[model samples]
Target: MFFLRMTAILVLFAFSCAKKKEIYYCPMHTSYTSDRPGTCPICNMDLVKKEDHSERSKDPSTLLRTEADGKMESKNGMESEIHHASPSNDRSSEFFLSSEKQQSIGIRTELVSRRSLVKKMSLYSSVAYDPELYSALLEYKQAIQSSGLLPESSSSLGIGNLQLRLRQLGLSTEQIRVWSSGQRDPSELIVGGKNGRAHIYSQVYESELSIAKPGLNIQFKTDVYPDKEFGGKIKSIDNIVDKNSRTLRLRSEVSDPGHLLKPQMFGETMIEISLPGLLTIPTSAILDTGVRKIVYVQTNPNSFRAVTVKIGKSVDTWSEVLSGLEEGQSVVSESTFLVDSEAKIRFGNNAHNH
Candidate 1:
């Protein structure tokens, strides 16, 4: 009986002890549980309570201690010197230490400005005959010639009759006299008319034709203002192509609001249209890496970071900043990449805590 009672009491005591012990487990890993403080099997991290005490401590109102000047303060504003970390110069340290200093790339900058001067380029074009219009004009001339109103050959009539033929062909009296007196211009007779001759000037030059549109914008410059601009709207496109140049001559009539532009003066011309929402960046702040463009951003004092960027057309020296940048962020404009390299060197030198 004594042996049975002792065994029963020992069993009850063992059960009580087992009930008093607490179990701990990792919040992330439910499979890991332990009675003593130790790491989880899978994660190899110290097993923590399933419910986190750090989570409840996050509320500012529940904070029990405050720190000022590197010292922890009690609920009562007591002051104590904080144990400041010593400067480290460990070169073999592996983990990253986020410090106050940041690195960045240096770059150049120029503000956008407007000027009166404009760059221009010149183009040489020739006058051409418009087959359609030429055919029409020729047909009209033939109708009158075949009707006997105008003689095909002015030599068929006497001088007076020739004069009459010249008039019929749409030639003025002056033109008829010039034709009859063939000593000066023999082709004058070519424009002879029985009624009136339509004077034909052999050296007549017309503007290029706008095949795309009946009318087009004409921009040109003349010798008067070698650097000024003159622009005009297309009056009409000649329905002809120059046989010599093989290009349709287009005539653009531009208005001279400033009247600085004049006729017959040679100048450069350009065609441009509007396209919006294009990305751009400052050209001065860029570092060209044979394959890509780069810029150094001032991430923090003494820290410049190298970043790649896309570039677009330049407005003067200021380049259109494209991707890899945000507005209002500061960047090192002058030698920013060099600055970044220097920063990296400093960081590597100070990588180890000192």
Candidate 2:
């Protein structure tokens, strides 16, 4: 019994000796590790359990941390210090690059400034006309004119009412006057007349009603005339919105100089709405991560810092800056990808060192 008891004691001691030590590390600074549960010494972030080294090797985030010849190395194999500023810490992100290196990499910078943000909304529309309606109206006017003498009972009143009805059917006051004077040509007053212009009818979403106004310039293009852009201006906006589509009708007049814009021919219309006074930057300067947008700003001749920014409307070449940037500051525009890659490498190295 004594021998068996001694054997059990020896086995328990060996098992305790074989138990692995619990390791902890900062998630942001993966290299900063501790034997006990605590916060990271470098970033002050909560230290989490360090999984098996074999499991960590499978993680892509850990790929930036490499081991070479008894030293920790960055993915780029270069040793550099990268300062990462957390908003909570109130520190600014900064790094260094030589002027010669900047030129070699084709880095370019532009000053952020306030500018008007013009948003162009586009929609499809077509030229349309109703021939039967115009024909019936013309016949009614002719019949009334042919009855040369008025009836004795309320004759003048009857004529006045008929003339008013004609005006309501889309006849201009001048057109009605000319018809009364015995100058009547149905084709002259109808759509697709000698005026050489076409009416374009488009629908604007209910949400866009605020921006839809008369006299706004519209440029349209058709499949038939792919190389040409026809110009027009908004003539009217419908008072009612379609219940089914929740859209409002918009009418415009376009000069059909070549008569290529035919009735029922579909085309795309573009209208620009002016937005006054917003900070903007070139679209090329922004680097979008999945969660945040980054821009590199030049603090000195050879130093650049990555700044987080909030962006708004984007026009052709510029994007509205909603926050995280100020006017008169210069940001790197060209070769931004290279700078970002270098910044990541430096950040990894610095974190590893810490």
Candidate 3:
């Protein structure tokens, strides 16, 4: 009877040793381990079963699987989820959302495309005229027309000087021809009245002087005609810069049909210039926090990921993309903030629970 009792006792002890012990850890604090399950001391979060860490460490290519708390980490200690990681550094960046939820939140997306971006610059200007220059040009035109009656040698030398002076005063060959033929008066061109066009004089800073040239379209608005927009092309750019303001003078001829745009009338001018082909997106799609510019890209159906992008000049409603995004990808254009908020709430709640 004593031998049988001893044998039963030994068998019970062996059976207990064979059963594996369950390991427990805090979901919020994965490093915190305990032999028995309980609330975490630091965060007070409930403890959960600790899965075998060895399996994850063995496969470096495998994705870090999330625990019940939605917390996931790779063997190398890097975050694996797209929504929770920094957009600039994360390689596998993506998040999941249902189609129904996306619609409820009013999320909308647009495909990225290559386009020729146009940059517009605005400048304040006023209508101007030079009475002395106009008078000199008129006299120069008469001298050239009457030079044919003088001695050939004297006419050649005298008319040449007068032509040079007229050119220096900003009279074009076409204008000289018209005035010499009595087709139009040189004074009328500078005075700008019933039958003439007004001259819009604007200043371009040193930074913008390179692009300031003739033939660029300009739209100007004056305080007198608040509802009207006057259109013209850059007719001339001065070679000299203003010593005080450090700006180059540019002139555009605008038709003054109503004679409302009088000399010294202040106005605003907009000049549009086309840029090279570049990737672009809507300005409304970007969430600018000053520190970083972020945009949500749709990776899959109802799945979105935050991406960091470098932006260049912004024109009107669109912006130039410099880097961090690919062409032909879809990005969330509307209600991006709501999507980010939802991701945080949903994932943050799960991260604390067992």
Write down the lDDT of every candidate, Cα atoms only: 0.43, 0.70, 0.72
TM-score of each: 0.32, 0.45, 0.46
Query: Which digits, one per residue and each the tens of the lDDT, describe model 3 over residues 1-354?
Result: 999999999999999998767788664455577989889899886776654545555675765656543445766776643233323333245555666757766888888888887778898898876686567766776677788888899888887887777666555666556657776565654566446467788888866775677889999898789999888888777656678999877777777777778777899999989877868888888988576788888876656677788987677778878897899999888887766654444344332121
Candidate 1's residue-wise lDDT over 73-189, tens digit each?
545665433222222342222122123212222234332222222222234421222233334334434444554655646523333454454444334555334434433333212
lDDT ranking from best candidate downward: 3, 2, 1
Off by over 4 Å in 3: 1-92, 115-124, 129-197, 203-214, 219-231, 235-250, 255-261, 268-278, 342-354
The parts of candidate 1 lying over 4 Å away from their true place are 1-219, 224-229, 233-265, 270-280, 340-354
In TM-score terms, candidate 2 sits at 0.45
Q: Which has the better lDDT: candidate 1, or candidate 3? A: 3
Candidate order by TM-score, decreasing, is 3, 2, 1
* Alpha carbon deviation, residue 127, candidate 1 (Å): 9.0
